[model samples]
Target: MSVHFEERSGVVPCKTPWGSWYQTMEEVSIEVNVPPGTSAKEVKCELGSRRVELVVRGQQVFKGKLFGTTVEDEATWTLEDKCLIRIVLMKANREAGNCWGSLLDGQYSADPWVQDQMQRKLTLERFQRENPGFDFSGAEISGNFAGGGPDFSNLQR
Candidate 1:
């Protein structure tokens, strides 16, 4: 006989006389909402040159393949104490094209991680300009954290 293939939605599942094989699942766009009782320490997010992965309780829950742009090291994870976890990505280049709204897209390029970074940078600059009295001596100078972001949480003080 000949070989045949079937496609559905965004994936392909091939069925043969012996068994069946399914293709990889689609990239996860949107925010990953984990179940209740999830701890911050239990959740792990891995950011690569062009992709983002999330693992909770030892299981890979979400994955997002980004565009040509690079992501910043400082990803803001605005999570609750012991409930849900929320995060925003920071794109490297600010003068590029339109950024992706969601995490995953059917196309080759998903999203760009930039908004959060620019916002934080601007906010921090504004605050420092307005309140020069505020002491920022405890902050460390590192990778993308040269001057530091607006949020003071990262500061050691």
Candidate 2:
């Protein structure tokens, strides 16, 4: 099957032959869709600081080095409804406003649209950081802000 990715929540999910994944500032969530009635024992996941491997039904679905470091000890996975595998990985470097361009290193990178959204998110985070007293949580960014966006460095409350 061809790899397919969809944009959601201002980020593009990286779809793979095994499943799909998206990331937050502190975590990465992966969803592996397996056949119906598949048992939990059929799924085996190995997560490390910089690598991950998933095996299903005795078949290695995915094995690759992760794009960033993760706290493997804090990672968690669950088999839901006997067919869906949900995995959450905690990033070791939970730096504020940081974003990952992809799940796996040197592969399955985010598209341009997703990259733009990530840039916007980082900009908003900078705004929030600079203006601690103001809440930029509900701020909305629109239009093509690439290259030469507004400079709020001089703005004072």
Query: By lDDT, who's the top model here?
Result: 2
- Predicted candidate 1 versus true structure: per-residue lDDT over 1-157, tens digit per residue: 4221112112222222212222111121224456678888888877664776778889876666755344546555544655555555555643212333333444332113343332233334334444566632232233443233334546676
Residue 62, candidate 1: how far off, in angstroms?
A: 1.6
Candidate 1 matches the true fold with a TM-score of: 0.41
Tell me the TM-score of model 2.
0.72
Poorly placed runs, candidate 1 (over 4 Å): 1-30, 105-157
Candidate 2 per-residue lDDT, tens place, 1-157, comes to 4221112225436677667887655678899999999998788899898999989999887789998899989999899999899999998876544567788887777788876766565555555556676665557788654532457557775
How big is the RMSD of model 1? 19.4
Which pairs clash in the backbone of model 2? none
Off by over 4 Å in 2: 1-12, 122-138, 142-157
Q: How many residue pairs clash in model 2? A: 0
